[model samples]
Target: MDIVGDSGATGYGVVDPHNGWVAKMRLAMPNTRINNYAHDGAMVSDFLPGGRWPDTTDAVRRIGVDQPSLVFIELGGNEYYIDRDPAQYKANLETLTQNIWQVSPRSTIVYETIWPFDPRQSTSMHSWDEYGAAMQQLAVEYSAGWIDLRQFFPPHYADDTYTHLLNTDQIHPTDAGNVVEYTAVLNIINRC
Candidate 1:
């Protein structure tokens, strides 16, 4: 019942991992083993290891060993940040999904949309909505579930914003955001 993904799922913006969504979820579900395999700036595509992170295949192998009941993959922004080609990104993501299914047939996979960050949205790489839609499409294609994290995030341009839900870098979520994220996942898991 743990999770996976990039910096947002890795507690990059926080001082302690215990304050991250994974830890909060562990606290919420004491019986659940939420092993944290996420890394900062992780991509859906298979590639060399990032700082302290194994490549996608190795990571998936490790997670498969755990046989996680539910796998939450929060990805996409890194694809844009790395400026990956859209078609290639789609292929890479599909492959990753297949690998997960091959390794854990009984597991439930959920593809999460990136948060509603305006600057990232304005990038020439790809609109944030485009990424979200791509994730949704893949989720449906694979008969998996999807969660648009944007719904839990307040707009970046509100008159009184910066509710500590996101970091100043505007990429990853903050400690407060981790709380909201845990709530969002909990809600979705309950529904499922």
Candidate 2:
């Protein structure tokens, strides 16, 4: 399975001054083959134009286009920071989804909704409820699977949702957070 995201997925299994929990899951799934390609501070728009991030085509090129059985995308959070235009975001997402399907027709694509964050701390508050609904709509439109990580994380993780899970900024997920995410991925795949 391919796990793509920002610092959350990238920081997994990495050791820094602040100990992360990705190592925890390694013990759970000793034989798990997780290919995490999330970069630090990445957004969906970055994959579009005018952003200094690698395009989806380029990123997927490195992942082998023979048709991955599963391709999970964790994005949208960073894009909310730049453009609040939902229309543009939706168009870009549609294009990206089409591209992925064209490259890997047999692949089951999973689109993750933006996780919840504390509105008090975050300068950009993209509505997870709305974004999630939109993502679900897109999933139905494209016949893909939609995973709602934002719904599972709330109450405890709300005050500073993303930060509470991150050792540094309010963007990355903590080890426990990663486990929650990983389980979600597993559940989705199992259902498929």
Candidate 3:
């Protein structure tokens, strides 16, 4: 099976040196063809028609209607920057997830929860719990599975350390951190 990973899916580094879930999955199953399209700092809004973010339609086109075996969505963290209204966030996410199903009904869609963020990184525009809950609800509405990444990281890393996921900024995953997140994802996928 071929796998396409999005922003949250792309770990630290150009070669993606860290062992992300995709890397582990590929290692576990040598036959799997895994492609990483996940760009760090990507928002679900980016995949839409005219959003400032990168659009997935091009990526979807790259898949060429053949529909890969699986499409993993790791977005929404950046969406928090847009505004903090949980209801609005839910509506936007609902539309995006539904569109994925509509476009590739046969491919499995995995919606991952945003890891707990450091309050220091974000303005008071929204709360982390609200964003996390909105994502969970979207998973339920779409009949897709949700993976809570917060469970994988050390509890001590919950605060400003969240910003350390990327060396450049607090949002993107560093190489090592990406490996951890990837491992968490792999564990979840293995259970299924």
The top-ranked prediction according to TM-score is 1
- Candidate 1: C-alpha RMSD to true structure equals 2.7
TM-scores of the models, in the order given: 0.87, 0.74, 0.76
lDDT of 3 by residue, 87-156 (tens): 8767766766666667777877777775654534345667767888888877787787787876655434
Cα RMSD, each candidate: 2.7, 4.1, 3.6
CA lDDT of each prediction against the hidden true structure = 0.75, 0.61, 0.62
Q: What residue pairs are clashing in model 3?
A: 5-38, 6-38, 7-38, 7-39, 21-182, 163-170, 165-174
Q: How much is the lDDT of residue 18 in candidate 3?
A: 35
Superposed Cα deviation of residue 76, candidate 1 (Å): 0.9
Expressed as tens digits, the lDDT of each residue in 79-186 for candidate 1 is: 777566767677777777777778787889988886776554444666567777777889988888888888878666663466577777776788888888888888
lDDT assessment of candidate 3: 0.62
Best by lDDT: 1
Ranking the candidates on TM-score from highest down gives 1, 3, 2
Error of 2 at 113 (Å): 1.5
TM-score of 3: 0.76
For residue 35, what is the lDDT in candidate 1? 77
Instruction: Give the per-residue lDDT digits (tens) of candidate 2, residues 1-192.
Output: 565566555654334513332344345556865555667677665554455665433665544544567777777665555536566667767776776666666778888874565433356545545555666778899888888887656644546543454435444566666667767766776687
**Best first by lDDT, ranked:** 1, 3, 2
Pairs with steric clashes in candidate 2: 21-175, 165-174
